[model samples]
Target: DAGITQSPRHKVTETGTPVTLRCHQTENHRYMYWYRQDPGHGLRLIHYSYGVKDTDKGEVSDGYSVSRSKTEDFLLTLESATSSQTSVYFCAISEGLAGGTQYFGPGTRLLVL
Candidate 1:
């Protein structure tokens, strides 16, 4: 995905600890999203933003939270890291319409030990 960067903010964290990952896009797309990938499960949506400060939880949003104070940044935070949350995280960007093409950033692997 162009103009997208998924930060591996933390490679490892202890269980019960809080973890925060970041995704940044320079394409000025109006829609940003977060997804997690596991072995058996495909990429599952976590949260998404349609604009600055306009965000909604996705399928796997129970133990996670998101904040998009700026259009260029989308922050995903795990309230408390757990082994179950260990997986590769991705950030995607979409053009004007969310139904349009989407550009995905590099996956950031987060390991909760």
Candidate 2:
């Protein structure tokens, strides 16, 4: 992807603890998203924002929240990190592509202890 950065490339947290991951983009795209990748789940959207302060929940949004107050930044927060949430977190952006093609960031690996 032309514009994407995920912070805390790797993390290990305890269960019931809170965690927040940052996603930064330089493309100034209007659509930003957060997804988690696992062996079986593949890539599942947590949330997405179409514009500043305009966001919506996705299929796997439970326990997660997102914020996009600027064109170049989007954030994902996990209220309480659980073992089940241990996966690679990725940030994505749609450069207004049709057919729902999205560009993804490297990813952040989170482990719940």
Candidate 3:
């Protein structure tokens, strides 16, 4: 009954290093999203994909990138790890953009030291 799942639930890295997180969904939704959660900023979108290989950047996508090769798999990569990038990353899935209900994964906790 799992709808979505994220790999490497917990990660610890150093500054200037590269990091990648994986999100997998069994719901077969058309839309996938990557978001980061911080104490003050709340949940911010990093990137999202409308369809396979069709992705776009979000408001806070400066240092993050995303790729969706298949309908059920989405990957988020941080070009270089930074202390400011340390947060809980979440993956969401939706059926459509207009009024779709997004389902979130458990979340990946990343620490950049």
Judging by lDDT against the true structure, name the best candidate.
3
lDDT of model 2 at position 82:
89
Question: For model 3, where is the 10-residue window of minimal lDDT?
Answer: 94-103
Model 1 ranges with Cα > 4 A deviation: none
Worst 10 residues of 1 by lDDT: 1-10
Candidate order (TM-score): 3, 1, 2
lDDT, candidates in the order shown: 0.91, 0.89, 0.92
TM-score of each candidate?
0.95, 0.93, 0.95
Candidate 3 to truth, TM: 0.95
Residues 1-113, model 3: lDDT tens digits = 45899999999999999999999999889999999999989999989999999998887999998888899999999999999999999999988782358889999999999
Model 3's alpha-carbon lDDT is 0.92
- The superposed Cα distance between candidate 3 and the true structure at residue 104, in angstroms, equals 0.3
